[model samples]
Target: MPTPGFPPSTLDSEGTPIWISDLAGGDPNHVLHVVRGIEAEDALEALGAKPGLIRSCELPDSKPDEWTSLPCAALGVEPGGSAALLAGRVGEWTFVYDDSGFTYDDAVTKALSADGRTAATSVYTINGDASLTYAVDGEQVEWVNFDDLELDEGFAGMPAELRAAFEAAGNVETEDFEPGEADGDILMRAACALAGLALTLDDVRRVPLLVVPFG
Candidate 1:
């Protein structure tokens, strides 16, 4: 059985998984985007690569520009996997592929090359409507919305302890507390991770996901 409130895993009329590329092809307005998971290859295949990929690393112990910063989480990375793959739209959104057995610097370089852009270390994070929006066959998906998708998926892998934390947080309710007040768990978890706090799976589940904030 499926959860009643959550978005359904997309299916076709015949109950087949819909390939985003096929969906996007029929109506250019339907852009299928993925930020986390083993779905990047599929997303790229569907949308095709655009020019000028940018990448950056998140710095622990400091809050970088919110809209233009990476998650500086200590994801328990091991040797030979010191850096995360901070790829995607450079400043706007980054998908941290940690323990990827790759260097962050090198991964960023390759990503930039894929779009035929000369990689530069000290470039201004792309801004403006042009920078925030991505198109597939001319359909637009805003990066702001895309970040929510990534954050949600990221928590999907969080340990059970964190989930309990969330359940606990969700319990503290007051007549004065707005519906949005329930999201403190999501903020705490994501902020902890973004600030390089050691994360347990328990922590992951407890994090309040700020979905509507981005939307």
Candidate 2:
């Protein structure tokens, strides 16, 4: 059996391979938050990497023809949906046809790299059916994808608050930030924002966004 921190998850019962990213929910010590697929190979390839990709089969089919709403419900960003929603808005991404053929380092590097403007970090597993159990007890780790967050101008300067939340979370400025590339700093900040809401490590599993509840 593969332990935590391993890469490239095995195929589910439906023959679909599960891709997990360490969204880590709120607990810095914890790992793995959301599990989804690597949608949009062109998005990945545009990021610069070998072909072969996976995408989430659970995405909203019809497109809403309007975007003039205050909090656009179309913002429809499922924590466990396909990366296509986020990656499609940004850049290209390719899928991996064979897991054994590629090394974990290579796959991770490709996902983490900013070559194609944006790419997924990698995949992991969520463990048992006791989903909440993962974040409870002594050891808690939730797997989440970085691409799922609706991180645009709506979350530009949210770093200060995010940094205070997660010990492992911080900013990583780089000249590499392209015109349309998603900023990692903003992403990390948003992660923290979401963390503030989580009391126990388990409370933050398969999270949606850095939503801070109003007092």
Candidate 3:
């Protein structure tokens, strides 16, 4: 059996995979906090979600019109519903949760735009092993395991000065640095600075990199 907060491979009676969140032990009351922005909050409230009564099963379904209110109708409970809501929004970035399989690394794997072009350089761990994944248009483009590579290798494309700052911050080291040790927020800011893009740390953390072409 999968532990709490982990995505489950077991299919519901309808054959849909189950995804869950750790917020409030998958309780709706606590997990709803993951939803941000007054717009998103209003949508949730209009959908009949209330504090302390929201359950993992009562979230709106992921429909084709995900960004619109169509998906906000608290129609029925579905497996992974809570996770879907939690990953719904954090301002402009739309979080994408991995529901393809059951794994302890069940987390927001991609944070992209509504148009599906830009994406965050995602860092996550599985069973204590850390890795980095770069994606575009919802497709993974690169994946690197921390153990097989140095921390600096991932940021080689970054500008020299920004890279140096990261190194000075102890985020990039040839021999001693390990993956999952560096602060993701700091690294994201460094990347943004190198690109000359003005963005908040929350934006950096949500979607670290912007995909070139809108996809």
The number of clashing residue pairs in each candidate reads: 15, 26, 2
Q: Rank the candidates by lDDT, best first.
A: 3, 2, 1
Cα lDDT of model 1 by residue, 4-119, tens digit: 11122322322212221111112111111212222322222222222132222322332232311122232223322222222222222222222121222323333422432222
The parts of candidate 3 lying over 4 Å away from their true place are 1-85, 96-116, 121-126, 152-154, 158-215
Per TM-score, the best of the predicted structures is: 3
Task: Give lDDT per model, in order.
Answer: 0.24, 0.25, 0.30
Model 2 lDDT per residue over 1-215, tens place: 12111122322222112221122221111111211223334433433433433233322233233311111113343322212222221112222211111222323333433332222223222231111111111122332334443323433333433323222322232476554443333332223223222122122222222111010
- Which pairs of residues collide in candidate 3? 57-77, 120-208
Q: Against the hidden reference, what TM-scores do the models get?
A: 0.21, 0.21, 0.32
- Candidates 1 and 3 compared: the better one by lDDT is 3
Ranking by TM-score: 3, 2, 1
lDDT of 3 by residue, 1-215 (tens): 11121122322222111222211121121111111122333333322335344333223333333222211233233434432333344444333222211221212223221134434332333233434444444454444454564454645764454345344323322233345444322332222222232333233334321110000
Q: Give residue 144's error in model 2 in angstroms.
A: 12
